[model samples]
Target: MAERRTIVSGSTFEEQIGYARAVVDGDHVHVSGTTGFDYATMTIADDVVDQAEQCLRNITAALTEAGCTAADVVRVRYYFPDRADFEPCWPSFRRYFAGARPAATMLVCGLADPRMKLEIEVDARRPG
Candidate 1:
């Protein structure tokens, strides 16, 4: 049986939403939809590019705690309210996920907070 574990990022929303930042089950790590807010300051950037960059930082923290890296990521999901904001973030995407080349999906939709420009979620495999 796979061992199940939960990772917390200490974001207030995690407590309010009643979910962990990520979960590790056996060899798989499933990260929750993470926003641009810096967990340390809970502050987000106004620019979509900057927000996307911060999203990577936050997701990296959760992935590291789950014993994996972006290289191990198998799937990724991007969420943004504006379609135009999505294209500008491609460079930031390549910065983190270009090498991994994981299966990806981008959604144009509303986020929980209006201040949030984007959110990222990922799934990674733990290497033996």
Candidate 2:
């Protein structure tokens, strides 16, 4: 069996919700839907674009911990509470994902916290 490991981001939500920020199984890494809250401060930005940028930052940290990088990401999913907020975040998303060019999808849906404007999830493969 491939060894599976969990990566914690020190967010209280992880403990309260009973989930890891990311999980690594063999060569694959799956990052959970990450919001804009900075785990250190537990605070989130009000702007969707800012939240999107922060989400990528958090995802990047998890990927790095899993021995991967944005370049290794093969798939990505974006969740937004409001459809109108999605386009405002495109530049931020494009900045992080242009190189990877991963398969991507965006959905307009509700989030756990009303303050959260967006959430991002990604799947990556550890490089050879």
Candidate 3:
């Protein structure tokens, strides 16, 4: 059997919610939906665009730890409470996913925190 490992971002939510920020199973890495909070300070930007940028920062960290990069991502999921917030985030999203062109989905839905404007999740595969 392949080894399965967990990646932690030291978010209180992980301990409270009982979930890892990401998990690695062999060559595959599954990153949990990450919000805009900067884990270091536990602070989130008020603007959705800023939050979107932070979301990518958080996701990138997990991907790097998993021996991957944004280019290695194969699938992505974006969550936002407001559909209007989506269009404004395109530039931020494109900054990471432009040429990589990973499969993607965006959904409008409620989030755990009212302050959270966006969440991003990704799946990546390490090349053989």
Instruction: Name the weakest run of 10 consecutive residues (lDDT summed) in model 3.
Output: 91-100
Residue 101, candidate 3: C-alpha displacement in angstroms: 0.6
- The numbered model that scores best in lDDT is 3
Residue-level lDDT of model 2, residues 18-72, one tens digit each, is: 9999999999999999999999999999888888888889999999999999999
lDDT on C-alpha atoms for all candidate structures: 0.93, 0.93, 0.94
C-alpha lDDT of residue 40 in model 2? 93
lDDT (Cα, tens digit) per residue for candidate 1, span 70-117: 999999999989888999999989989988899999999999999998
lDDT of 3: 0.94
Clashing pairs for predicted structure model 3, backbone only: none
Q: What ranges in model 2 sit over 4 Å off?
A: none
The alpha-carbon deviation from the true structure for residue 39 of candidate 3, after best TM-score superposition, in angstroms, is 0.3
What TM-score, over all chains together, does every model reach?
0.97, 0.97, 0.97
Q: Could you give the candidate ranking by lDDT, starting with the highest? A: 3, 2, 1
lDDT winner, 2 or 3: 3
RMSD of each candidate relative to the true structure: 0.7, 0.7, 0.7
Question: Mind sharing the TM-score for model 1?
Answer: 0.97
